[model samples]
Target: MTVSMTTRASLLTSLRMMVLLAALLGLLYPFVVTSLSEVVFPSQSRGSLVYDENGTIVGSALVGQPFVGAEYFHGRPSAANYAPDQVSGSNLSPGNATLRERALQEARAIEERDGVTIGEIPVDLLAASGSGIDPHISPQAALIQVPRVSRERNMPITEVKNAISSATENGGIVGQPAVNVLKLNLALDEQARGMP
Candidate 1:
């Protein structure tokens, strides 16, 4: 049986429709989604980065890293060792002896530096966060290290506490207060350097 011109034209039309649909769904859909995300959530689309007063990008507000010196407020322990690409948590269980040993050493070091009892160490201060990218710390975590930071910087504890308070996030309806480590650390650097 020979196909008519009309039947061939109909098959060609169906093929064109399939190609158009594939282009729209596969290419245009992703482009639209990306454009919308950039428009609606720009900071997040850009990695929620924090910038210093010099307009230099310092780091993301979502991920945490270390501040080794006594003058800076330390962030939570990271299993990735502060590498963004290597984000991960230490998988040691609570009952793991190595985990306990590491936690105890960390707690002891914090206590000695802060002049606080070992019991006062915040759990977050000793444990690596899941994903190892928590940029915020509990207010309690910030406070426990305040004395040490203040003493090292030669600033009053009250001033340091005030800074922490200013850095704190509202309870979000009876939620506990929290501090963004990046912002807080930036503010401390500014204050210490007397930058406006």
Candidate 2:
């Protein structure tokens, strides 16, 4: 088969364009963006890792960790069980028997544990986040658990509430207030240790 000159030129032009776009978009663009992000937001660029007083990494500020003990405020119930590798929702329909049963059981547990009536429990406490690894809970969710956390930690309720307030990220105009459970717990630890 004979190839036309115009066809040959067009093929060469297409190949050159593809290589140029690949380099710019796939390689150079990512490199530039990553570099800028690292410089602009160091902690977040590195996973927003939370550290202890001893400079040991405990967890990331952006991901949730389960805190079942009474002394610590709990995060959302994770369908993925807070596993980063398995971040996902249960995908059960809202009316599914398993989902409803799980929520009811959790509500009862929270009532007994937090000493609050079922009606007082926040929805965030009973349901897992869509990512199933959300590090935050509603501020109301954190507040409702204050009694249990204060009693378990042997700390004053005011102090526990202060810690929650410190950990809370106020949504301001755009979103609802949320609390990072892991940071709050770590702050509680620091407070207990008399560290700033």
Q: What are the Cα lDDT values of the candidates?
A: 0.85, 0.90
Best-performing candidate as measured by lDDT? 2
Evaluate model 1: give its TM-score: 0.82
- How many backbone clashes can be found in candidate 2? 0
Name the weakest run of 10 consecutive residues (lDDT summed) in model 1. Answer: 2-11
Q: Backbone collision count in every prediction?
A: 0, 0
Error of 1 at 93 (Å): 1.6
Error of 2 at 91 (Å): 1.8
Residues 1-196, model 2: lDDT tens digits: 9877666557788899999999999999999999999999999999999899999999998989988787888899899999999899988997799998999999999888888898778999988799999999998898888988898889999998899899999878998788989999999999889998
Give candidate 1 misplaced runs (Cα > 4 Å). 1-26, 174-176
Model 2 ranges off by over 4 Å:
1-12
* lDDT (Cα, 0-100) at 191 in candidate 2: 84
Give the clashing pairs for model 2. Answer: none
lDDT of 1 at 130: 87
